[model samples]
Target: MKKFYIKTFGCQMNVNDSEKMAGILRSLGYEKTDLPEEADLIIVNTCSVRAKPDNKAYSFIGNLKKIKKEKPETIIAVGGCVPQKEKESILRFKHVDLVFGTFNFMKIGELIKRAKKERVVEILNSKIPEEDKVPLIDSYLENPYVAYVTVQRGCNRFCSYCIVPFTRGRERSVKPELVLKEVKRLAERGVKEVHLLGQNVDFYNYEGIDLADLLYMVSEVEGIERIRFTTSHPCGFNRKIVEAMKNIEKVCPYVHLPPQSGSTKILERMNRGYTREEYTEKVMMLKEEIPKVALSGDFIVGFPGETTKDFEETLSLVETCVFDQGFVFEYSPRPFTKASNFKDDVPKEEKNRRLQELQNLLRVQAEEKNKKRLGCIEEVLVEGKSPKGKELSGRTKDNKLVVFDGSEELVGKFVEIEITETSPFFLKGKLLQKVKV
Candidate 1:
């Protein structure tokens, strides 16, 4: 069988894209290979979200140059954001055989066929594929408990500091019935949890149904113990979603609603389409609905034109919201984004200082929040052995990672553990005397 390797970077959307690619390749009689060196094809599903991951992608591609030398017949393909963003430049690299974009993902095999004959093939601007057009893959690395179900593709929100709208294109959602069918199929295959993925998750609307209705439907499936969605935009989170989360027993008590900046002026410049007051109201209402819900957020520290006052407003929101976790980054210009057109005058040193300060304070808040979990019993979906194999790692309903010792047979089962210690990143636990169904 032909062997292939796919290395994915970026958000859950990219993960879902890679899975679709794997499925497509498998349908072509290809087998997934762990070692890139042993593969007939290598695919780097890239991300261009921030500067670091973009740099990482380039470095990875540079290394693959050697692999191409060792295996002259092996084809190297680049897909996703970086390829979509730098289509022509990517082809300049002698090692890159094909370049495809987010919309052109389904055309990978076609592009490879062309590359074999033409020596270079790039399909970065093909029309976006319909949701049902992509093949469903029997997973190469199947997890018993968790699956990422993508109900939608792309984004329309042109956040000034974001490149998603340009690279991922307009929002197009899959029908709710299709999503439920996929969830049911996953359940039949032993998946106990499904994390719905989208760039703007709450914006999912197919025909008349929205994300709230979708969550409610997925909750009804047998064998699905939990449901979660991520990368929610504050503007799209309506009361319906909040109420649905409260009423649905299977929806996890965890939300990652990103309030990029708390300052009204910065929000305006970012085209986030929501005010600080509006964001606060949504968070307050959700907390009222799901009292035990743990909140996480995304923050950008040094957006162009941000002042000290703007930075203070962000810090103030962090204090008021008390986020359990956050992904904080310094603003970096991306091609084709509105913000990239503005002067990037924020000093590098200042940006670094602001990001570090915000990170330090959040670490303190996270540690304090986690401390409260100590001595409490929480149910965990045992993932697998920790890196050392002496400990086991799993996640709680609040989406916190917990590690403890247990029998290897318990790896895929849900077990209750008594928390014994806490760290900013994870909770340490011991096997509880009782197990629940």
Candidate 2:
């Protein structure tokens, strides 16, 4: 049996992709290994969402040359966005035995078989293969309470700042029946939570079944205490989905809908397809439908032609929306993206200043939001003991982290915690009695 090791970086979708790859390799009699140095085959599942991740992938690939010197037979393969984007450059490295793209996962077994004979193989195909053979590997979830259930593969939105459209290819949804089957299997395996993964998750509409129906269907599955999905496009977030979040018992009230920018001008430039007013309306609708819902969002500061006023509009939206938590990032130009053709005009100092301001503003709001939970008893799925065993760390239904003193036996179970203390980042809780749902 060939021993292989795989390392994945970036979004949950990429993590699921890595799982599928591992499953494929396992079906081919390849056993997974933790140490890359000891493995006969090593795969680096790359991500290009941010410059830091791409830089890390490059650095890791460069370091592999040293490993190759010691173990010449070790097949070093690169896959995902980095391989899909930097096709020929990855081949420049002598140690890289294989380069495969995201869509070419079905061909992994064949690629490895060929690499043993040819020493070098690149399979970055333009079209996604028809086969939807999911991997059958033992899942390596960081927490047993939550498991990512991937319902779709890829994106259709060509947002100027995004590389997802290129790397993930066009939107191709999984069969709804198949998704239900996977969820059922996961339930049987003792998984309690299912977070549906996708780039534009709400856009999942196939064979008369929309994401709403899927949500309702998944909620019916036993053992799943909570269900959540992420990276929802504003254009795709409709009234039906908002209503589903409220009606579906297992569907958590937290939504990760990326508005990208608050300025309509910047949104238009980014090809985000929705205006600030439209995005705001979506938020309003969700709030009206699910009043208790805690909102989370993403923001990119300093796009190609972003101005101070444009940035202030963002701050204003954040103020108006009062998002529970937002992941703010300074715009980093990605190669081959539409925005890359525009002037990288946003000064680094200005970008940093805007990012800091956004962070500071959000910090204040987050602190206030957390304070609301001070006396409330929140349902938290105990993940595990924190780095400081002084408290256990778990996420509330709204996805807020609550650290409390709890028995290790309660790790995978859901327990109600009374929020006693709060911070902008986390809440200190007292494990109130565990209640049966």
Best by lDDT: 1
Which 10 residues in a row give candidate 2 its minimum summed lDDT?
129-138
For residues 1-437, write the lDDT of model 2, one tens digit per residue.
Answer: 88988888888888877877787777778888888888998998899988878888888899989888999888888988877876876778778888888877656778888888776556555646532564434555556567887787777888898998878888877787778888888888788888998788888877778899899999999888889998788999999998888888888999988887889999999999999999999898899889889888899998999999999999999888888888988889898899989998889999999999999998999999899888999888888887687778889888899899978888888888999999999999888887652
lDDT tens digits by residue: candidate 1, 1-437: 99999999999888877887887888889998889999999999999999888889888888999999989899999888987877765777788888888877777777878877666555546566777765555544445568899888788888888888778888989888788888998898788889998899999998889999999899999989989998788989889998888899899989999999989999999999999889998999988888889999999988999999999999999888888999899999988788888988889999999999999888999999999998999999888887667898989988999999888788777898999999998999999843543
Per-candidate TM-scores read: 0.96, 0.93
The list of candidate 2 runs beyond 4 A from truth reads: 1-3, 25-34, 131-140, 387-391
Task: Provide the overall lDDT of each model, using Cα atoms, as 2-decimal numbers.
Answer: 0.86, 0.84
Q: How does candidate 1 score on lDDT?
A: 0.86
Give candidates' CA RMSD values in order.
1.7, 2.2
Clashing residue pairs for model 1: none
Model 2, residue 39: C-alpha shift (Å): 3.7
